[model samples]
Target: MRRSGPAVEQLIGALIPRPLPRPIPTPAPLPNLPPPRAPTGPNRIELDVARLVRAGRCSARTLLHQLDWRPEHRLVVDVADGTILIQRHPGGRVLTDPRGALTLPAAPRQLCGICGGDRIVLAADLTRDRMTVYPMTVVVRLLAEHHARLADGRRGR
Candidate 1:
């Protein structure tokens, strides 16, 4: 028996291994970012804390543990119009969070006022003794500009 036509051709093609499609690259930064304030640095990594919440995985605790910081370390959270920055307090003090994440006065809003309904970016700076969090308007803006940058390039593409 001979197999032919488009349907049969498609069936045969399905059994062959094919190269995966390339990932869609991240979009460029906004025109309004400060020229000198690009997000770059070796200690940084981006994470979607809001999604972690919905996934039932406590990222706050996991992040703290990854940075080797204990509950006694101070937390510095700077909430601004377009960003929410969380870091170890410069002076360092005793603070604790029952849920094992940055203890905020309230859950930080993912929506950004400047971006108009867009989710804010959540990036972390992991260091020998502390972790810094920068929930910005765009992950690329902060991570790209910061010196010594490291991104999770493997998305299983």
Candidate 2:
């Protein structure tokens, strides 16, 4: 039987040199930086989600109020990039209802693939005085893209 006695330990210690203790490192100081500036632009947008009612009507009273839209206000409804854009136009044929509910035109709604009872995103651009409606399909695509970018460790648009 082999025994690991002090004699064996002494032999091992003679074969290996003991290492010196390492000094703890001090952390470096943080660099002085300027304060973050306030966001400045004419593209400040407010976002809301609402369900489209029957007859292509959707309730967006808060967004409309933010854009300063009032009853009888003329609005132009159009579709761009599969999203519905409602803008205040002097020659617009559509009018805001008395109760501030928006009656989206059937043509534009169809173009954006929006249907009654569908969930929609209302993005109101305060400076532009316009509201953009994104159907569920568009919203899903956007969210998918955003998540994909995040997974890839990249910034989302």
Task: Please give the CA lDDT of all the candidate structures.
Answer: 0.50, 0.88
Per-residue lDDT over 26-83 for candidate 1, one digit per residue giving the tens place of the 0 to 100 score = 9998788556854456655535453333322234666666665576777665555545
Residues 1-157, model 2: lDDT tens digits: 7676665433578768899899999999999999996655867888899899978887888988889999999998888999988899989999988776889898988888888999998999998889999999999999999989788885433
Candidate 2 regions with alpha-carbon error over 4 angstroms: 1-40, 154-157
**Residue 8 shift from truth in candidate 2, angstroms:** 50
TM-score, candidate 1, is 0.38
Q: Please give the TM-score that candidate 2 achieves against the real structure.
A: 0.71
Which candidate has the highest lDDT of all? 2
TM-score of each: 0.38, 0.71
**Candidate 2 structure lDDT:** 0.88
